[model samples]
Target: MSENNKFKDFFKFGDFGNYFVRVFQKPDPNQKSNYNLRMMHGINKISIVVFLLAIIFWIVKRFI
Candidate 1:
């Protein structure tokens, strides 16, 4: 596969894209907003951050 195709294969699933999108992007104005929704998204962002840190730590521990 070409370099681009290989890179595309790595991200073939959109889970990673959705994760970053949900964390960094602003909420859609057209979508409904409420206290519970805000809290849910907030918690999701925190979990994503923690999960990423764990992955990084694992890689570092493995290398070291």
Candidate 2:
């Protein structure tokens, strides 16, 4: 849990918009691994994509 490792995880997870990579991430043994954790991450990733798309669509519809 060092600051350096946190920085690495950010890029390792694919910067920002590519959060879907969590679906393919291997569970870290050091932390508690379970279905709920993985499922939550997957759902969160999907939400992020959906939210971004909605924002883009809204902006396009409003201005163009």
Candidate 3:
């Protein structure tokens, strides 16, 4: 598959439900290391943190 196709497939497969599954899946020692996986995990963590912070800020704004 071409690089562009692979990029599209990533989104198709990595939709929200699959994302959480991927995030919680156990690491395999035998599998070759993948840069994409690490990058996705980092993005997931950052997204979750940012979302939580936004919610907190919204709540505080409502109270004040």
Candidate 4:
């Protein structure tokens, strides 16, 4: 499928992306906080992995 159609289907799926969009559509402040928390958790996990990879690369470079 084309990129546009693939993106359209992504929002249609009953998953985090759909739920996240629904939360943003609301006017509730609590929903916004929940969304932020979920996003932060995802970022934190990614950051940790990236940091570990960087450390491993540095260690390997030092020995080479």
- lDDT for each candidate structure: 0.86, 0.76, 0.81, 0.69
TM-score, predicted candidate 1 vs. hidden true structure: 0.72
- lDDT string, candidate 4, 1-64, tens digits: 8999988877675675465454444356554456777786677667766887999999999999
Clashes of 4: 0
Residue pairs with colliding backbones in model 4 are: none
Top-down TM-score ranking: 1, 2, 3, 4
When 1 and 2 are scored with lDDT, the better candidate is 1
Ranking by lDDT: 1, 3, 2, 4
Off by over 4 Å in 2: 1-30
lDDT of 1 by residue, 1-64 (tens): 6999999888776887867786668988998899998898899889888999999999999999
Instruction: Please identify model 3 stretches exceeding 4 Å from their true place.
Output: 1-31
Error of 4 at 21 (Å): 28
RMSD of each: 2.3, 8.6, 10.0, 8.8
- Deviation in Å, model 2, residue 29 alpha carbon: 5.7
Error (Å) of candidate 3 at residue 35 is 0.3
Query: Against the correct fold, how does model 2 do in TM-score?
Result: 0.53
> What's the alpha carbon RMSD for model 4?
8.8
lDDT of 3 by residue, 1-64 (tens): 8999998877685477576676756778898879998888888878977887999999999999
Task: Please report the candidate that would top TM-score against the real structure.
Answer: 1
